[model samples]
Target: MSLYMLPLAIGPWQIALIVIIVLLLFGGKKIPELMRGLGSGIKEFKDASKEEEIEKNDKKE
Candidate 1:
């Protein structure tokens, strides 16, 4: 049962193919915009995490 239920693993080739598909679908011009949005999302997530940590420290003090 355990062997039959093992997860399928993703390899580097599969990741490359996915990236190629995304580039083709979005076109060359839109890739930068997509990356920029992704960057901002990561920045916002980090900011929120820092704010939560500050609030926790405040409560302890």
Candidate 2:
């Protein structure tokens, strides 16, 4: 058996609405701080993954 999934059809208006909602929820002043924290979290996740890969490689050799 196989399962199929359909992707969401998001248009420009949908995107604009989402942006407006986020802006209203987070406010302009907080967006930059949120983005900075998000970026740092992503960087830390990548660094951890790389370290795990290196450890696996070291264990095999």
Candidate 3:
């Protein structure tokens, strides 16, 4: 029951409002481009992490 420790739980109405705001701010066309860039960035991060783990295991062996 700690206000500072726990993140606020978003309800469905809050989510819909947030989505509306994002649409207003970024517009319809830019959202897909932003999502694509975000997806690629995440993919690159995952690939880098896997490579690092493989390298660490090789060094240990």
Q: Put down candidate 1 lDDT per residue, 1-61, tens digits, no spaces.
A: 3666645666788889989999889999999999999999999999999999999999999
Model 2 ranges with Cα > 4 A deviation = 1-7
What does candidate 3's lDDT look like per residue over 1-61, in tens digits? Answer: 6897556877898999999999999999999999999999999999999999999999999
Q: What local distance difference test score does each model get?
A: 0.92, 0.91, 0.95
- What is the TM-score (0 to 1) of candidate 1? 0.78
Which prediction has more favorable TM-score, 1 or 2? 2
Candidate 1 stretches with Cα past 4 Å from truth are 1-8
Q: Model 3 Cα RMSD, Å?
A: 1.5
Candidate 3 colliding pairs, count: 0
lDDT of 2 by residue, 4-56 (tens): 33246667989999999999999999999999999999999999999999999
